[model samples]
Target: MKKFLTLLLAVLMIASMASCAGGEGGKFELGLVTDLGTIDDKSFNQGAWEGLVQYATEKNVSHKYYQPTEQSDDAYLTGIDLAVKGGAKVIVTPGYLFEVPIFIAQDKYPDVNFILIDGEPHNADYSTYSTSANAVGILYAEDQAGFLAGYAAVKDGYRSLGFVGGMAVPAVVRYGYGFIQGAEYAGGELGLAAGDLDIKYHYTGGFAATPEAQALAASWYNDGTEVIFACGGAVGNSVMAAAEQAGAKVIGVDVDQSSESATVITSAMKGLKASVYSVITDYYAGSFPGGRTLVFEAKNNGVGLPMDSSQFRSFSQSDYDAVYAKLAGGEIPRMTELDEKGSPSVVPVEISTVTEVA
Candidate 1:
């Protein structure tokens, strides 16, 4: 009888330890790695993090996140491995910064599932790193969202605008190109003359939050550009600051920044939260969108203008309704794929030639 009691106690202790180590009664654990930033940058990283948080809360699952201290590749992998070692069944990487590390992690821990946002790990030979079959990639139709914002800017009577970009990547260029197209389309539809509104563009070549963005934006504001569109990760915050200080309007990116950038006009938002939330929920259901590259467009509610209170509080209901109808009716075309290798493709909506500067 004493021997039986001892075995039973041992079993109970083991079960308790497992439960304590894992989140939510031993249910599958989820984890996220941010890209050289925190989880609350009010931007891309934040949007992805929010989605996971909401899903975990709703599903009563276990999850955690770790931001890198040194903000290097080694630091990123260490944070990711920390979660994996802690028994995370599914790990999420927030940005393209993790392209290389995720590729390595997938091979190192074949049993773990990975969700990579905004990037895929591929070698020069077009061969993906030897990764498990459990990894998935999530991308957005950012060009389309940028198009909508540009169209709305013109419709709202802001012709001369400025574009501030974080990096000269595909995503940033997509937003830039789409905005130009939307403005051109609006000018034609509104019967406005060409060259009525001039657009000045600049790229900071970095994603970190910096005062340099504000300084760049200030120069444009001084040059009479009344509205600005900023797409840098942390650099965007500086743009918003300049807009607020100069009493000019700004457009935000990734998530809705109307609330975060309250002094700004609106944001060209990707449904990052929804995408993140969907991945986590799928994992719980054993139907994660693994081994696939998921592309979300405006048609999928994956991209749109901001409706957050900070953005729309002062906007009349009719203004919101009008802009929304235009987007929904396909009168607005958001650019998705651009042919330009490192820059945004310039389709002449108005000007025949466009010069890119960084």
Candidate 2:
């Protein structure tokens, strides 16, 4: 009888441990909802997940990620529901695509905390904007990152440059504008006439790596565009393919894309991993800055070029450091204000040749 009682007690203890491991009674603390991509996208999704995984692994907490079934409001909402149902206390949503879904989720999951990266919560039609006490919005200074790419490309002796953007969205526009500004600044430093350095700029209207984008980029390379800055998500892949064929260089975007293609010289990166990590740390420390929107910029080490793998012969790390300091110290003007048409008002170079390819 004594042996049977001891065995029964061991079984009960094992069952309790299993219940906790199964996420019963809210055992999971961290959750991530991927935005329109897989966790290994090597872009936005990967960057954010690296942060979440790093934090959770360090703290030895329970965490999981949910990928939406499709790219729609209902699909993303269902993902959030699943994450919350799995006992997630804090959720992180990556990308601007999650804006509307998160807007709804803030109220639906009132008890759960949310960290929305790259955008704020907004209505479907953008008629209303709100960030509840349970949510925090995060944005990055894409212009600064773009500026570094342009500067590095020009300094590396690339006279003719091209920019292939995904769309004329605010983030893409800022990158384009800053790239042009940096090219003009470098042209002045090199004493090159404005006409001597030409820039071909176009928006691809979508983010997919379509053959159309590849053909467009190939045509630009054939027309003597030395290096093209691919500023979109998968659009960079298209540009890289064309660059490889044309024996030309390419500038990557969003993350360190040097590993993606040999044609890529460097990438303009945002502090996605760092920013997400900081937010998670804050949430755990009970200092989550909820009910507010946060912007990451050069002043906060938020934007720059990846120099470790950059193939620049003339642009040394010290040169980059000097320029970064100027930008960070506010010596160089930031392109923050936009015009009525949502374009940067001040472009130092003549962009009369910029064509919007359909």
Candidate 3:
């Protein structure tokens, strides 16, 4: 009788502990739904995943990521459904592509907290927009990141440059415009003559690393373009391949790619990992900023360049900090992806000839 009582008590204790560790419904308390790319793409997905992994490992929490079978609204929603079914209390979705799916999923899974990066929730037509109490939207100052890359490049003596963006998406547009602006700012400091700088800009129409992107990058390098800002997702891989062949320099985007290639001088990084981690911290602390759009900018360490790893011959860490201070203080002009006319336009610089390629 005594043994039976002891065994029963032990079993109850074990069950209670299991229930406590298993989270709300399943095993994972945190979840991530990748956007159109694998987690190892070393871009948006990877950056967000790193943040989740860092937090989960530290707190001994269980986390998982779901990859959609296709890039579609339905597919992304299905991924979200899987995460919710797996007992995720908070789900992280990277990129603006998840805007509509999250918009729908927020209502469908009102109990699940969502961390939507780079966009806010909106309907398919974008006429109606709302973020439920369970979701928080995240946007980065991509322009600031791009500006650092361009400023450093010109200061390091790169006279000719190129920008090959994946698509004319808002984020990409912002980076492109900022890169041009940063170069012009540096040129003004250097008192460079007008037309001494040439910039070739093009959009690949897609984010995939097509052979065409590589060929175009190679052409730019051959035509005297010194460094190219690869602002697209996998499109950076195409540009890196071209740089390897031409022995030219390249600037990476989204995350640090200095380790990915020898030709990569620096990267325009969205503080993806930091932003995601901070939000997850808030979610677990019962202070998640639901229905709020959090903008990460230089003022908040949302964007920057990996100066320690950057291969700049002239640009130093002090130079980076000085410019970064101006940015954080809002000395630079406010960069917007679209002008008041709702069209993409570059505030042209007289020193550089920007040839926009179709």
Candidate 4:
């Protein structure tokens, strides 16, 4: 009888320990839901996934992430439900596309803490919606990063540049506007002049590579645009194709593209990996910024430019040092000024009669 009692106690102890490790009660279980893109796209999805992975490994916590096979409300909701049902205490939803689904999910699962990157829920009146106390929104100053890239391009003697954006979202628009402002700044500060240098902008309306992005880039290349900033997910990959064929330089977004595309000149980096990692780490540390909106900017090392690699052998080391210093020192405000409605506009730098190019 004593042996039976001892064996039963040992089994209970083991079960209790396993439950704690799996976050069965109060421990943390993190889960991430990727947008339509795969986790390996080496862009937004990849960065967010890396953060989650790093946090999980460091904390020795249970975590998982699911990539959507399609772009639909159902797809996002299904992934969220899966995570919630899987014992997730915290859920990270990457991309602006998840805004609506996350809003609804936050209501459905009030107990699940959510991190919504790149967007926030809004009411019918367009005001920020008050989600459950468990949801936090994350955004970045994309315009500042684009501005740095544009300034660097002009400083490198590439006055004519093209911007190819994915979707008409606020993030993409900020990036485009920031690029224009930077080019204008360089033109005024360095005397490139309005007509002497050209800037073109196009919206692909999607994040993946499509014929539209390639065709638009081809047109820009034919018109003598010296560099292109591709600000879409896989759509940016199309810029590489155009650059490889036209022998023009291109800037990447989210992640460094120089390694993937030998024609890539540089990249406008958002430090997505770091942002996601920090949020998760905070949650583990009981300091998660829940129910608040987090904005990452140059001031926070949230956005900036990447180094020139083999693809950009044209850039001198001095060039990198100069731009990096200016940006880090806050001597250069890479972010674009915007109206209250989040419309992209040139603030602080006033350029009269600035027109879009064909």
Candidate 5:
């Protein structure tokens, strides 16, 4: 504990000195602290950063980002502390992993405002979840986005599907469950029985690219799974690599990942860039919804598929519009973490099985 505290103190002190310098232009008033990935991972971190950059560049506000040295609660907290010390007025944290750290930081730096995307603040034990007056939590309707992906796949004639998630966090779970729901919905449209569609599900335990994840994806492809929804940050890269090797297709997550690889047929996209830009705008306009958790879903145009960039042969723009209308208009009921019993029962048990690959 002593050694850890000493290291933390050193980090904070260095950050303080940097803040004091203020560079030639001035201190960076806007800050972003990344989770376990770089800003250009073409997923979570990048999406959020793009929004910040767009807003900051237009407003001529100084902005910077700090990456943690490790992937633990302490390491994450350290990153926040550094941002605060470095004169960050408003800090944006882009994933659920920030829940605990932002929980602690909200109290530690009461004057600094925070925009927490994809999660709300909560203690480690989760017995308490509270966003202070200085912080605002932003959540996306991932289920809706995932639903679009699954519905499109089945409508376009793919029966065998696989879902590879980075972790079983609430966001990822919502995505997986929505995908299953969509597949079932489409299967019914095609007059197929409950046992007609097949889906394989698993979580990679973390949001990084790994040999194990790639190998597992390759194995699933080899076993006849038609397309895999790579829903875990850099883990998607691993799945995409596997798809390239096996000549299979992929459904990406978080943002428009179609550009990342030709194997990516589409992406279940949340408005990461637009939402961040909007929140920052609100902050500057004195209307930031502090101390509250905000939900961005289809009703508000917060989530959908990138139709213009999606490579679908039969799932035309008209097909997308029909399904998306149902989702956005509440005609389609969404299944989230709350709707699960033990786990999201990939509905119609006879047609589906969740393997939870090791």
Candidate 6:
């Protein structure tokens, strides 16, 4: 009886040690909850995942990502729940859609740290704004990125430019506004009057790469618009398709999408990967700026055009450097605050022919 009891005690000790080492195949310390997309969407999700992967690999930490079953608040919350169950100490949620969901999860799982990108946590009706001590919000100066793309396009000899936005959301609105300003600035630099530059701006009212978006892009390209800055999520894909068919140039948004299509001249990029990596690093270093919103801009190398891949005729890297320095040094003006209707309150450039297509 004594020998049998000793063997059982040894087995129980081994089981306890195994549990402490993390159950099953070991729990992932870092988790990413994708917002309505796959890890390789080549946009928001991909950018965040790339950062997570880079940090995890360098630190030799376990990380994984979970895609929600649907694009509803409940589905997103469920994704967070799953990540926590998988031993995720830190969770990264990308996109504005997670705003409400993260608001709920922050209180529900106070022990879990959250990195909400592109948005802050709020209630469904936005009547309540709260950032728990365990969460931080990340925002970018998207207007700066858009400005770079516009200036590059004009300097590259594209006189007639167009902007096809996915939706009239705040981010998209800022991109359009900055594009117009940048083009106007370039016109001044090149000795062209305001009316000499023609810009067609339209919002597609949705973020998908739908047939209607493609049709609208096709119309713009067919009408002699030399380059169209496609500033939306999957909406850029539609514009790229149209540009390819029409042999027109395109400016990509969000990330460097030059690899997606040959027609892509350059991309107005936000440092999604860099921001994500920085936030995660801070979390591990015990310096996480919890309960605060972080803004990334040109001063921190947060937004710019992919210079190496840009197909510019005379706008060399030096030209880009000068403009970027001006922007960083506050020599260039940023876009005005967006109104409730998602429109810029101020328009610096006299866009002679701004049209809104249904």
Per-model TM-score on C-alpha atoms: 0.82, 0.89, 0.90, 0.82, 0.88, 0.90
TM-score, candidate number 1: 0.82
For every model shown, the clashing-pair count is 1, 0, 0, 1, 0, 0
List per-prediction Cα lDDT, in the order shown: 0.76, 0.87, 0.91, 0.77, 0.88, 0.89
Worst 10-residue stretch by lDDT in candidate 4?
A: 349-358
> lDDT tens digits, residues 83-121, model 6?
998899999999989999999999999999999999999
Q: Write down the TM-score for model 5.
A: 0.88
True lDDT of residue 62, candidate 5: 88
Kindly report which residue stretches of model 1 are placed more than 4 angstroms away from their true locations once superposed. Answer: 1-28, 124-132, 209-211, 308-345, 351-358
Instruction: Please write out the lDDT profile of model 5 over residues 1-358, one tens digit for every residue.
Output: 9999999999999998876565523577899999877999777899999999999999999899999999999999898887877789999999888999999999999999999999999999989999999999999988888888999999988999999987787888889888888887888788887567878888888888899999999999999999999998889999999999999999999889888899999999999999999999999999988999988998888998898898887999999888888888899877753533225554434444455554
True-structure RMSD, every candidate: 7.3, 6.6, 7.6, 8.1, 5.4, 6.6
Q: Write model 4 residue lDDT over 1-358, tens digit each, in one string.
A: 9999999999999998897466535433888898866778787778888888888897788877776668887888898887886788888888888888887888889888898888886543455576567888888988778887777787677867888887767788888877877777766777644376667777777778877778778778888888898988888888888888888888888777778787787888888889988887787789878778898887678887766352453556676566656666778755544544433444444432233433
Task: Rank the models by lDDT, top first.
Answer: 3, 6, 5, 2, 4, 1
Give lDDT tens digits, candidate 2, residues 186-262: 77778886487778888888889999999999999999998999999999999999999999999999999999899
- Lowest lDDT 10-residue stretch of candidate 6: 349-358
Q: Candidate 2 has which clashing residue pairs, if any? A: none
Q: List the residue pairs that clash in candidate 4.
A: 144-334
Model 3, span 1-358: residue lDDT tens:
9999999999999999887556445567899999987889888899999999999999999999999999999999999988998889999999899999999999999899999999999999999889999999999988888888888999999999999998788888888888988898899989999997888888898889889999999999999999999988888999999999999999999899999899999999999999999999998898999999999999999999998888999899999999999999999976774653212344668888888887
Better of 2 and 5 by TM-score: 2
What is the Cα-based TM-score of model 4?
0.82
